[model samples]
Target: MLKIQEIREIIKLVDNSSVDEFSYEYEGSKIELKKNKGTAAPAPQMVQAAEEVKQPAQQAVQQAPAQTEAAPVQAEESKPAETTADDANLHKITSPMVGTFYKSSSPDADAYVKAGSKVDESTVVCIVEAMKLFNEIEAEVKGEIVEILVKDGQLVEYGQPLFLVKPE
Candidate 1:
């Protein structure tokens, strides 16, 4: 359980710093502070209530777009060689979180999908590994892969475009 003074201090630290999120653990209690002015804070009561109040703030920070400005520029510069003349025809499958983009199931395996491969909603196009968990990323829209937007082994952030596809 976190004391009100501790929560206030955490909030103050968050406001004073440029950090988007701050987490601390002490005496078996955890404190997580997030920057999200959009979320309304609940009137502080029990520790459980404070945690509930903080949920939206944490979610917003986790899902926010402002954190990805740097990655998109890099991804844009590294657009695959095969992506030409069809800029308007492409649809993108983007990363949902910060993770390592993997082209194949493993180093020796073939890529799950490649340029010119057709994919449907259920197709597992690739994997994005975060915190040692391999996440199978799907093609949400049916399309032929026109270009892959990230290099294998590259670090990708939330909402970063991963593939450019020509929708069927």
Candidate 2:
């Protein structure tokens, strides 16, 4: 889930940073933390070092309000986009997790895949970050990314369409 480096960075921030309790507010998710130099820290630290994560552990603690607020924003944004749906011959590529979708590895970087780009079963389409885990989602079929169903950093539902692929 979470990459080792990202976790280590968080841990280092907690351990070395004076902001013992830091929070990040995204589109619809709010991650809050209350670091109590206790036993919980060790296990989380170990878990963080073992994987390359995309989200923060504090996500679970603060996602409720954020999720509620985000719903309306996405709903409004999808209105115009849904019009493109009339071209239903395309296949929908949905998300496997309830997390934030990242189109690229980092900010200011190009997306991993884009509309009109051809892809194969082994091609990585995007990354989903959930509870501090950065999971990679690959194209299961050989096709072209005809449309991106969801916006980058948007909270996606399990099985929610992320892209529209026109198979080759």
Please, what is the TM-score per model? 0.59, 0.52
Question: What local lDDT score does residue 137 receive in model 2, on the 0 to 100 scale?
Answer: 81
lDDT of candidate model 2 versus the reference: 0.62
lDDT per residue, candidate 2, 32-66, as tens digits? 44466654322221212222332343333234544
Instruction: State the number of backbone clashes in model 2.
Output: 12
User: Residue 157 CA error for candidate 1 (Å)?
Assistant: 0.8
Residue 131 lDDT in candidate 1: 61
Q: Can you write out model 1's per-residue Cα lDDT over 13-53, one digit (the tens) per residue? A: 67788787666766655665556656653121112234443
* Per-candidate total of colliding backbone pairs: 0, 12
lDDT (Cα, 0-100) at 31 in candidate 2: 35
